[model samples]
Each structure stands twice: as C-alpha cells, then as structure tokens.
Target chain A: MTVTPDQVLDCSGLACPMPILKTKKAIDSLQIGQILKMTATDPGSKSDIDAWTKKTGHELISYEQAGARYIFYIKKTK
Target chain B: MGETSKRLAIIAAHGSLDAAYPPFILATAAVAMEMECAIFFTFFGLEILKKGYADKLKIAPIGNPAMPVSIPNIVGVLPGMTSMATGMMNGWMRKAHVAKVSELLNIALESGVRFIGCQMTMDVMGYKKEDLIDGIEIGGAASFLEFAGENAITMAF
Candidate 1:
C-alpha cells in the first residue's frame, strides 16, 4: 500500500541529530492525523525517527531506502 | 505515552567547544523524545551563556583526549596551539557538515530546554544578568538540585 504525505522535508547531506532535529520540528507543525514525509541522507535517521515516532505516539506508516537516502512517512496520531 | 512526565537535568561544568556540545546534544535528544530538559552551566561553563561566546569557543589541545594524535604537553603549551587545535577541530566538523555548536545551542533552546546559569559562578566570575543571553534563569546549585532531584536522570560534564 502507498501513503501520501501532507508535508515533505528534505534533509539531504545532514548528519546525525540534525536530521532528527529537523524531523521533530517538521512533525510538530503537522496537525493530528496529518502525514509527514521526510527524506534524509543520514543513516541514523532510520532508527532515530522510529524511536521518536514511538515515543511521541506518532504512526510510522512506512519507510523505504533509495540509494543512500532513507525516506520516512509518518502520521501524526496524537 | 501517558503517565508521568520525564525530565532530564544536565550540569555543564566545562566551557571548551567540545565540552559544550554534549549537554546540548543530550538536551536536544531528550526534548525531541518529549521529555523536559534543563541544563545548568557552572564554573567556566557559564561562559557559554555569554552573548556570542558559542561562536568563540575553542578546543584546547593540551588536555583533550579526543585529538586524533597527541602532542607533548610542553608543545601544547605553545601560545598558538589552542587556536590551531580549535581550527582543526572546527575544520573537521565543517568538512563533515556537522552542525555547529551555536546551531546545536539554538536547537536546544528552541526545543524548550531550560537554560540556567549558575548565579554563584556569575557573582564570582563578575557576570551580570545583562551579560548573558536572554531567557536564561540565573540560579545557584540549590535550584539545579531541585530540578535534578525530581528528575530520574542527571548528568555532570
């Protein structure tokens, strides 16, 4: 299944914590049930975003790998 | 995610450019995870609270273990070594596109992490309230201890 995001953020060439930091800010701008698609070049974002989603009660709808980039689709559940 | 609130308190006791990063990193992480975070800057660490100080922070090679190669203590004592080391470290971080110390501080602050300056240190060090960045809560050890005592995690650096 495919899910479209309400907002998209590109964090290419950024390193650990930057990607996570930007993701947090982007997620906060979203309303409940809105989806955010974030693409990051930092490998650490995969786990960081996952943990953040779990911690904040957001829904990690899906994630996909494309070359060195990791793309995450998250829905704001809370 | 509902129950009791989580809080983290950190003591930033050093002022080196490298030493400054850890507290901001931890506080940013905690705030990102939806936990309340506070950082207390004491001793020389209070310098980081001074306006424009983050941009001027330097890593002194004389005692930093994280240097890729060690220089003799006598050599490190040379007048220009600290700036050289700071330049090298800053270059490396920039070459890798890592976020700067100032950027990290901004992130921590914007994330709702409380920044408390040590009032005792401020008095001893001759730092006036106007000398610090805005929104800093100036307090002594007891104030920090109150936050630390209530938190499950506290770290000193």
Candidate 2:
C-alpha cells in the first residue's frame, strides 16, 4: 500500500539537531491529520524524529529506508 | 512510554566553547521533547550569555584532557595555540554540519528555554545587566534552585 504525504521536507546533508529542528518547524504548518513526509540522510534522525513525534503527540505512520535515504511520515495529532 | 518528565533544569558551570554546547543541545532537545527547560549559567559559564561572547568563547588546549593531541604544558602556554585549537574544532564542527554555538543558542531561546544568569556570579565578577544578552533573567541560587526543586531532573555541566 502507498501512503501519500500532504507535505514533504528534505533534510539531507544535515546533522543531529538540524533534522529535528527543521521537522519541528515544518510540522507546525501542518493541519491536524495532515501527513508530513521527511527525508534525511542522518542516521540519528530516525530515533530523534521518533522521540519527537512521541513527545509532541504526532503519529509516526511510517519510517522506511529507501536506498540511502531514511524517510519518515508523521501525522499531526493535536 | 509513560509521560516523560515535563520539566528539566540544568546548571552550566564551565565557560569553554566545548563545554558550552552540551547544555544548549540538551536544552533544545528537551524543548523539542515538550519539556519545560531552564538553564542557569554561573561563574565562567555566564560568559555564554554576555552579548557577542558566544563566538569569542574558546577551548584552551592547555590541560584539556579531551584534546585530540596532548601538548606539553610549556608548549600549551605559547601564544595563538588556543586560537589555533579553537579554529580547528570550529572547522571540524562546520564540516560535520554541527550547529554553531550561536545558532544553537538562538534555537534554544526561540524554543522557549528559559535562560538565566546567576546574579551572585555577575555581582562578584563585576558584570552588569547590559553586558548580558536580552531575554535573560538575572537570578540567584535560590531562584534557580526553586526551578530545579520543581523539576524531575536537575543536571550540572
């Protein structure tokens, strides 16, 4: 099954906090129930984003590895 | 997976650039995790709150155990060695895309991390209110300890 995202954020070539920082900023613009697709090369972003989503009450619908990129789809729950 | 602690308090006691990053990074991460955070900068650490001081903060290689290479105490005393070491570390962080100290400070502030400057330290060190950055609350040990007392965790760095 394919889940389409309402928004996409590219965070390649960034490190640790940048990906999480950018994700936090990007998610604020999303409406409730809207899905944000984030792509990053930083391996740490996986757990960082996971932790962020859990804390913020966002839904982490998907975390997939496609080739060299790690992709995350988050839904704003609040 | 239960509700994480909603508050965190940190005491930053060192002034070196290398030492400074941990508190800011942790504060930022805490805020992102929806934790209310406060950072109290005391003594040398208060230098981070002074206007235009973050960029000037340097890691003195002399007697620093974490330096990549150890130099003799006499050689470490030479002029320009601190600057050279600072430059090397800055360049490495830049190449690795680590956020600069100033940038991290801005992020932490914007994320609503409470920035507090120790009043007793400032008075003893002869620092005035205008010497620090805006949005900093001048606080005494009791005030910061109050915040710490209410929080689940208080860490010192």
Q: For every model shown, what is its TM-score relative to the native structure?
A: 0.93, 0.93
Which pairs clash inside model 2? none
Assess each prediction's global lDDT (C-alpha) against the native.
0.87, 0.88
DockQ of each model vs. true complex: 0.75, 0.71
lDDT of 1 by residue, B40-83 (tens): 99999999989989979998889666698687778999999999
- Output the lDDT of residue B96, model 2: 84
lDDT of 1 by residue, A1-78 (tens): 378789999999897678877888888899999999999988888889888887787888999999999999988887
Find the candidate with the highest TM-score and give its number.
2
* Model 2 stretches astray by more than 4 angstroms: none
lDDT tens digits, residue span B95-128, model 2: 8888888999999998899998999999999999
TM-score of chain B of 2: 0.95
lDDT of 2 by residue, A1-78 (tens): 288898999998888788887887888888999999999998888889877887788999988998879999998888
When only the first chain is scored, the TM-scores of the models are: 0.92, 0.94
